[model samples]
Target chain A: MLMILDYIKEKAEFINQALAETMDQLEGVPPVLKESMKYSLLAGGKRIRPVLVLATVEALNGDEEKALPFACAIEMIHTYSLIHDDLPSMDNDDYRRGQLTNHKKFGESTAILAGDALLTEAFGLMAAGAKNAHLPLDVALTIIEEGARCAGSRGMIAGQIYDLQSENKKISLAQLEQIHRLKTGDLIAFSVRTGAHIAGASQRTLQALTEFAYGLGLAFQIQDDILDVIGDQEKLGKPVGSDQEKNKATYPALLGLDEAKRKLSVCIEEAKGKIREHDEIRPARLLEIADYLLSRDW
Target chain B: MLMILDYIKEKAEFINQALAETMDQLEGVPPVLKESMKYSLLAGGKRIRPVLVLATVEALNGDEEKALPFACAIEMIHTYSLIHDDLPSMDNDDYRRGQLTNHKKFGESTAILAGDALLTEAFGLMAAGAKNAHLPLDVALTIIEEGARCAGSRGMIAGQIYDLQSENKKISLAQLEQIHRLKTGDLIAFSVRTGAHIAGASQRTLQALTEFAYGLGLAFQIQDDILDVIGDQEKLGKPVGSDQEKNKATYPALLGLDEAKRKLSVCIEEAKGKIREHDEIRPARLLEIADYLLSRDW
Candidate 1:
């Protein structure tokens, strides 16, 4: 456990350094725009999505160097989504991850541009990664296209649209699942599969990783719902009951709390089963990441 | 004259068809979301950016089919920016291209998502273009990165930030130029340069196109400002004097109308000079495009 923790820490430091370098290239950008972008980007988080990218690459014995930019790019997309979601016009949150939200710290205008910059830059980073790696044009372009699709209308944006429409409305469990699966699930699945794509994993192994990550993403969202109800505010760094206050649908809100927990546990185990069935290769890092996901309170 | 007009009409039709085909793929995207996206994307406009891309490719005798997706992608980016700019929190414009603006047509939340989806899908279309063209990976990646940079923090978004900040303020011509260069110029410049990039134009030719497009873009903005004051709203579609209403520092506002017109004439001449000096290629289409820019009232 300690070794895996250390591994995550080491990979996280690499992502942090890469992200800083990425943010430093904002020549001629307004100081406020740059500052707002850096604030949210540098705000501390678990770096789960980037870590998943690196871990998947490692699990397939791919070079971390080749995957590092991609890992950072994934994190950028995640950060931008959070910034935009926290806007007054969106989720209307004042704080995120224990710091003032982008729109709160900077004015709403700057924060909005900051998010736009981050999202746009993520693509540049992705293309640069593929270019720097000397990947084939088709392969590099396919990877980029995949990232776009996973993050765009059919995936994350779709999820956000559904989530917004569902606000203050009573939605069925099946509908809730649909929202999470597209909104949160697609990007997580993309992170894992992108690493596998980088590593040139076989179809069988790629299929396994996709299945595992899909289950893991749903479980992660379920646990988040559960945490909102029972987790400590100090540890979580945000107010509890935001979902309830918004009357937003959540796994725990629709299902009973115990049932939600049970469902999360079952899903995690199922994800682990997918990993274990991958020709008994023993993907230690990925399984450990899943374990950590289930255990984290924040 | 007739040939150039015919060529422009032909390319514009191709772009329209391609855009329609692209929008038809939003199967699972929610109805309102899909409708909102289609509403802005399919809204009739001059299609100037896409036309430039197509024209540049034609000048270089490159494959228009290969550049079709990229041309559509530029238009998508243009449309998305308009949608976001017209949002209640942003420009608060209720109409664009003579139609109700996206937020006004569908609602703020869906408009935001629609803009995001349009932007994301544009990148996807670019990648798909590269893939379909079988362009070398490095070249394609470089082009993609360039587009991202031009449209991202250091370019279009930066311009937007500055524009928002400069609202209701007296600003110098230099400052106004910077805002327009970053906001409107970079992407227009990008539209020209990207086509050259696709055609693998010589570095010298690319440099000429960049310089030409830079001047042309500024001239285009000045014409827009002039039209805002003197042109009929019936022809321009949207209301006139929006810049004055917003206290925007336009070339005319900063330079006086006569001087702004002089600046526009000098710019058009300088842009034409760049085209003429382009290794004697006789880029007739580009010259006509510049001429059209100088004459267009809308």
Candidate 2:
């Protein structure tokens, strides 16, 4: 357990440093824009997505150095989505990760531009990083295509729109699952797939990882729903019951708490089973990460 | 003039068709999201940016078909910027291109997502297009990097932040020029550069086109400011004097109308001179395009 924790800490530190250096070295950008973007970017999330990228690469015995930029780029996309979702017109979030939301800290317009700039710069970083890392162009292009698809209209954005529309409405469990799968699941899946692809994993490995990712994503979301109902505010970094206040459809809200927990256990086990079946790849860290999510309070 | 008009019309039609086809062929995206994106994307603009791309490629005798996706992607970025700019929290415009603005027609949240989706999908289209066209990975990566840089924090977004800041304030001529150059000029310059780079032009050709694009971009903005002051509302699509209403510092507002016209003329001359100096490349059409900008009302 200590080893897994140390591994996560080391990888997180590496990613955080790369992210900061990338921002510090960026030139020609306006100071205000940089500040606004950096505020949310470095706001100290758990760095789960980027860690997954590095972990997957490591699990496949790939060079983690070459995958660093893609990891950072995914983090940027994640940060940008959070910024936009916190906007007054969208979620109207007053606080995120225990700090004032982007629009609350910066003005709304600047927040919007900050989000735009982060999303745009993510692509630039990927392309430039691929060039620098000497990653094959075809592989780089495919990864970028997958990144855009996961983050765009057909994936995360679609989930966001659905989530917004579902606000104050009583949506079914299946619909809730669909929304979570698209809104957050696709990007999470993409992160794992990207790491594997970069490592030159075989088709069998990719397929197993894909299944593992899908289950892990759903389990992650279920735990999030459960946390909203029972999480400590200091630990969770936001007010509890916000989902209930918004009347948003979530697993614990739709399913009974016990049933939701059961479902989460099922997902975590299924996800672990996929990883365990691929023992030749030694993805023990991924299984540990999945278990951590299952038990995480924040 | 007739030849130039015909050239613009032919190229615009080609671009419009390609843009429409791309939208139609996009799979798995939500219908409402697609509708919202398509509304703004297909709105009748002059298609100036994409046309420059095709025109530059034609001048260099490059494969226009191979450059088609890139041209379309730039247009997507342009459309996304417009959608975000017209948001209620931003410009608060009720109309664009003589139609209801994206947020006004589609609602704010969807409009925001639509903008995000379009911007993200543009990168995907570029990567996929490069793969399909068998464009060298390095070239494709460079082009994508340039596209992101031009449209990101250091370029278009920077200009937007500056423009927003300068609202209702007196800005200097140089300051106004800087804003426009970053906001509109970088992307336009990128359009020409991408076309030329795709054609594998010489370093000298690239440098000349870079200068030409800078001059042309500034001239285009100056003409736009001139039109805002003295042009007809019917031809211009939106109302006139909106800049004055907002107290925005435009070229004509900073430099008097006559001086702005003089600046425009100088820009046109300088831009045309660069192309004409490289007459061995037979860039007469580019020269005509510059002249057309010098006289265009919309």
- List TM-scores for all candidates, in order: 0.98, 0.98
Writing each residue's lDDT as its tens digit, candidate 1 over A1-298 gives 4587788788888889989988886577789888898899888788889999988988888877888888888888888888888877778998888888988888776777788888888999999889889876766787789888889889888999889889988889989999999988999999998898888888889889999989999999999999899998878878898888888899888988999999999999999899875772458889988988899898
Write candidate 2's Cα lDDT for A1-298 as tens digits.
Answer: 4577787888899999999999987899899999999999998888889999998998899988989999999999999999999898899889888899999999999999999999999999999999998888778999999999999998999999999988998888888889988998999999999999899888899888988988999999999999999999889888998988988888988888999999999999999899886754777899889988898889
| lDDT tens per residue, model 1, B158-215 | 8898888888888888888998899889999999888888888888898899998899
How high is the lDDT of residue A285 in model 2?
Answer: 92
Best by TM-score: 2
**Deviating ranges (above 4 Å) for candidate 1:** A280-282
What are the lDDT scores of the predictions, listed in order? 0.86, 0.91
- DockQ of candidate 1 is 0.80
List of chain A TM-scores, every candidate: 0.97, 0.98
Q: DockQ: which candidate is best?
A: 2
